[model samples]
Target chain A: MPGSTLLHIDGVEKRFGGFVAVDGLSLEVKAGEFFALLGPSGCGKTTLLRMLAGFETPDCGRILLDGTDIAGVLPHRRPVNMMFQSYALFPHLNVSDNIAFGLKRAGMARDEIATRVAEMIALGRLEGLERRKPNQLSGGQQQRVALARALALRPRLLLLDEPLGALDKKLRDSTQRELMDLQRRLGTSFIIVTHDQDEAMTMADRIGVMNHGRLVQVATPRQLYEQPASRWVAEFVGDVNIFEGRIERREDQRLVIACHNTGAIVAAAPRQSLAGEAVCVAIRPEKMKLSRQGPAEAAIQAGAINRLEGTVSNLGYLGDISSYGIALDAGATLRVSVTNTARVDVDDFRPGERVVVWFEPDDCVVLDP
Target chain B: MSTRQLFTRPARRAAIAPYLWMVLFFLLPFAFVAKIALSQSALAQPPYLPTFDLTAGWEALKAAAATLSLDNFRLIFSDELYANSYLRSLLVAATSTTLLLLLGYPVAYAIARLPERWQPIAMVLVIIPFWTSFLIRVYAWINILQHDGLLNQVLMALHVISAPLVWLSTDSAMYIGIIYSYLPFMILPLYASLAKLQPSLLEAAQDLGASPAKSFWLVTFPLSLPGVGAGVLLCFIPIVGEFVIPDLLAGSGDMMIGQTLWLEFFANKDWPLAAAIAVMLLGILLVPLLVYEHIQRRQLEGKQ
Candidate 1:
């Protein structure tokens, strides 16, 4: 159901004093799409979310909701709602009353408001806590109340700022699952702001990675991880071994880089114009196979030439996977992870073992400097 | 110890020294006042009849107690002057407290919203008047409100008035004096409450589609009720029993209860009637205090 642009932020900029919180940021969210603004803290993701929720106005540019620029509109008048990170439920109001606040403000009929509040209460699984104030509820219950209150109005767009930040791990997982299910069911366009990459990768239909108040790249989670737009995005999204090098040659949909760390690296599916001399070859930790023998003997894809010889310097056994820090003879350290197929630690590489690490050219992302 | 006893220990362990002081200073004096209120005024050193010493025998104490009656209270009820003064005092207290609230809430809110470093400075400005003698400040108001004073001169120079306004010895002067002296009392508690209000709550209300005014009334105002209750009580109780401001600044046409009580005690030397009036005023004041206490307890219970 993701069709057409539901919201467009065109070169929006916000500044507090002289510090640019959000600088010339542009994005488009599709209708019924779960969009996440992913970044580190102080990356202006929350600021952009605040602007969408009408708590702030951009110093320049436009925020269009359904093609209507809503700069002059007040927050209460805008068809946008937000679930705050603090889950700012009204402490004075009971659960039902908190959920009914927006409906009441919209001047809905009393009976209709009551019905909507009851539905929300049922949705939040707060059946018997209708008359309990926010302070009386647990953290999860308060989070539910915040969600019910914001969703009660049925706004066009719902902005959530780190909605699961206050929850414990178990609650966070269940809440994330429930949120994804609820979004798919309601088909409401949600733009959630979070610094947690895992939450973004799992829940978002499209993730926009922000850095220094700018959108570095916006793509699907898989695309972002596999082919990041730059070395920063490549390193920021996930753990990757970036070999800084110069582009030596460009063949048909293929390129070779003379790396400073691991020497020449052949990469495939070279999408960008191979115009820049300096570039970085980004390879995911799991893409490379490690073996005491060669790549073919290790059951890796045949004819793979992105190979290097290194000694295992460090080993991390994370129960499900074993990660190895390999120090190449050329003096570069690369982290490689392999799935622990056997339960009793069979065929696992150890520290100080000399190993051959190799990956196919397709697994390598050639990014411009 | 049992859980019940453990839970009850704090209340039971409340410092006994304060209670002892209260007995020596407040309770004992109040008991003497009540005894005098029930007795008849006489042309004696202490000015009340049927007085008994604690060292006296029980028979003597009983004889004195038998002579004590409700005649003072009966006289106060029958007299129109005391009733009228009581009503005037209540009206003044109510109206002045309303004015104080209207002026103080916004100032307190502004101070609370100031920058972090400036908040204490703003609070200091609000309480700066406390550094001066309250009597001197009220006396300063006397100079300002009197004929040919600074206020009238400024007004006349601005051509806002043709003649000097009769500000002194009027209800307006009395109210001005009361408000000036009690403004800090109204603002301090209000500021404390307002400053503690989280900014996220207001933003949440706005985010949830409540307008600025709606958010204030719905979230901000209701949350600050404790401060409102405290400020109202702090201003209302003393203003109702106020004697100095009305005696100094108000006209003699209508007397407040404080003035009437003072006249009865000092000029007329009717100590019994004055004691009865003081007890009645305290009774009236206690009504609001008890109501406030009940609300405070209910608020605490609601939190739990």
Candidate 2:
């Protein structure tokens, strides 16, 4: 079950009047996988999730759950549950009753429903707050009750619509980890939609970056960060300095590009084919380093390495790293980050100081325009 | 300045204005009625014995109070006509309120679920009947309910009835008038509450595997209870003391308390006994309100 496809969305499209909310999007979610649909607001991540949960029917699509088309099934008749972003807990029901709602609806025996409610309450670590109404509980406790309620029926695939969106920063972090653990133990597939990139990276096994109602790229979080599919995907996932360039040379395992401002740049391996000479070379700030002088002459033999000479234009002393904005000679500004490895503020780089920024070729991502 | 002078003094006056108005208009009149209920009927101008004289001072007032007794109350309690009217008034009020709820709830729910642009227009339709004068509407109902009237003609045309049905001077006609008049009062509050309900709550219920009917019972109805209570109290209280429709439509076989009071006060000119009946009817109406308040307090206590 873990390896098999549980939910197969084939060319799902939803339109509101003239505006397309979900384009012709197709995807497969493996059973027991922690998948995240990551995007900005109104990017159709929420609309796609709603379609899976039977809240919205697609204009054209086949939603196959274990090889049965369930697109026309009523929401109450479907074996799917969604944890709403607002939690949407029944305000009148107490914690125990909220957890037992789905179970009782399924016509479970009274004793069995009580036992499942108790188990879910304990699973959420809400021991003493059983009788409290949803309004009476704190925000964190209310979220747990919502989660417990959604999980009560053991749905084939649980949908979470930004479930931790209401919690504060500190609670959000811990809850994310707890949610990961719970999903792993339950072994029920989960597809969580969120606009926060960090939350998806922290909890999802794989991430799908969506834009304009279509999935731009889907990959493991590390792959999405280290090897993005396009310039937009690279820039959207994390902070990156993208330089306009054209392919200068192509080899078996590596390619070299000549940037208009920074000059020649070599990439060890490019994921996409050389669709055109015009492309974007992207590098994360932390992957490159800064120093007062250039590297030793032995580095010149390695043709894939890059070296840029610039004066530091701006510097930010964050607690863990110092970011330097370099004003390149050709008028292109590049951002480079250096990790703070020493206790004291040593290796001080300040604004208006001359510096050499350098990085290896593999640290760079070659993205198509 | 202190809080009392700067803040609370003005605020306190504004808050006390309604109570002061009630004391002058309501409590004082009730006191006069209570006095009349206790006094004996008389052949004099005021129709009650031992009227207090201000010029005669404290001694005369004391003598007037001593003459007041519970004799009118005893007489009304012993009479079958008064007893039957009270029961009939309560039963008609309760049944009409129930019918209003059953008929009005779905219409309110539909209006609330309408698109935002249509809701205000639909609500105006509900309130439009109130523009016509109430007496004119009741008179129109008389025409519709009479023999060979519009209702019988329609029924005959549809072949639903073999002949003209006897509708006038019956409980059915009385209920029809009361419900038609009070439907707006029932619908407005129910719509207000139902519209305030989050659409997501119903979706959440369905996602949790509740069928449409079950979701209404579990989520929609429970949350709209405050509206139900308000609507019930609003329509039931006034309908219990209703006079116009009942007197115009209901048969002479049974009478409501309002008819009894009118007859006792105007026909027989027994002001003391009529006042006593009015006081007792008010006491009976207070029972439901007291019960509603008790339940409200217990719910609050349960929450805390």
Candidate 3:
């Protein structure tokens, strides 16, 4: 659950010449939420973030910060700061001065500026580097400096543009955790714009997936992965096997989907749907189990389990899990991943082997086609 | 070693070739001038005493060395004309360079901020003036600035002035010529520095609560210092020793170092005196050149 809304973005639209960068988009960001705008490049996540920071004016819309419309306000006057994707630290100034820039501009006393600079240096753990210019710092250190500089003014909202884009895998992992801690400690609303789904999932309180120029879905990371609103969102968040079908019947909590190639597939349709309605059955690869024995001989739950006969076409060993691609006799390919809980296996599945892939009806998600 | 590694050795050697050329064409001539500055003037074929005589014995070589003196340097220092000419040259060059910067900076900034496709076209426009000979360009200015020329005619027609302004054959005319001739020198480096600046930096500055004007001062200007220094050096150095513009436009009344050096060498046939003047000019120019070099080295070190 989110707190009281702090930013009310209503029908904001931006266009660069003829290309619409951000279509009519409306969203509400909670006061202390660490929200992420996740999308592929050119999906307008960055343009939306820039609008919030006041670097770009929307073609038509009102963005209310705490109920006050700040449409005409300049970026400098707006109570928002952004950490650029390139960090954009002032190359000429030392780390301490860079952090102190905003404070000094606000007419803070020299002593006060120094004290605030010291506090930021401590917060960023940039000790002994106060006098070093931006170029003198390492990439990770530069990122921290940028973060510290953005946080110094204590803006109502902090916009981060791909904050961890420049870091290596090892550094990015630790930095993501650190950023979450910082945002939580400060209680400032954060809007991170990134294309990395895993980064958004690991750090954000809620993720807003964008496509083309509009927000497709906004949900918590778990909900976004488990119950994506559409097929595009499902495939974008994580690996999912899609079974295109039409609703044959809705019985109790199960939806009997008449899939073309696989004949019939049962999915747990959260929403009530009429018979013959077009829908897609989305099942995560990890939810499906692979066995050499058929469902009837294996004695899997009769009506609750959805089973398909297929031959293993390919397999990938990912240390923690083994993913197998199964080509069904009905002319559909489905992927199933099994956890490698134990090294020794009773039956090790390989390519060209006959297998039965099974998943419970509860594990299936039915989305509108 | 691999074939590629073997190739790098010769490439490294080849890189030193330009430095050798600089030593030969630039340093050797300066050394000759310096040697002449220390020698006495004579009516000989070379027109200076104490030539390096290999045919002469050790005793004659020593005698020739004895002929070398600092009299020409002393003469230059003692004469008010030579001293004032150096000062006047500095004043004109400094003023012209300052004017060029004030005029060129905005043009360069505008070009740098032009759309990506238009940037190269605008840069070519700036360099297009350079296609014509520098002398011809300066002469074109004279046609416009002359009392009965296009400028006075426009001023009169517009009722801006009743009398024709004596625009030519003055220090102001010389300044116009110097600025017009050296503007490309100022613009090119400035454009390069400004073009390399990431737009994100300015955006970040504004995001950090600095207004547009403040951002320009706090971020943009400071980052463009390298270009400013480079453009200043490019214009200032040559203008300090500038001859043609001042000679043609400003007349011979205000004698800069170049014209003085020419008169000393050609008119007075005082080779040693001219060499002494050249050495003094070099000495004066060294301070800024060395400062520029120091800045460049520091920038390189910062990058590393």
Question: For model 2, which pairs clash?
Answer: none
Model 1, residue B23: what's the lDDT? 100
Between candidates 1 and 3, which one is better according to DockQ?
Answer: 3
- Give the per-residue lDDT of model 3 (tens digit) for A228-324: 9888999999999998888898898788999988879887767634334888888999999888885674445567788799899999999999889
Per-residue lDDT over A258-341 for candidate 1, one digit per residue giving the tens place of the 0 to 100 score: 899888888885676645688888899999989887566544334347789999999999989899999999889999999998
Candidate 3, which segments miss by more than 4 Å at Cα?
A272-276, A294-301, A344-347, B1-8, B56-59
Q: After superposition, how far is residue A25 of candidate 1 from its true place, in Å?
A: 2.2
Docking class of 1: medium
- Against the hidden true structure, what lDDT does model 2 obtain? 0.91
| Prediction 3: B-chain TM-score | 0.94
- The i-RMS of candidate 1 is 1.1
Ranking by TM-score: 3, 2, 1
Pitting candidate 1 against candidate 3, the one with the higher lDDT is 3
Where does model 2 sit among the CAPRI classes? medium
TM-score of every prediction relative to native = 0.90, 0.93, 0.96
Q: B1-304 in candidate 3: lDDT tens per residue?
A: 4546766787978978999999999999999999999987889889988798888889988888888899999999899999899999999989988999999999999999899999999999989998899888888988999989998999999999999999899898898889888999999999999999999999888888888999999998888899999999999999999999998899668699999999999998889999999999999999999999998899787766
Q: Can you tell me which runs of candidate 2 are displaced by over 4 Å? A: A248-256, A260-264, A297-304, A311-318, A346-348, B1-25, B43-56, B302-304
Q: Judging by TM-score against the true structure, name the best candidate.
A: 3
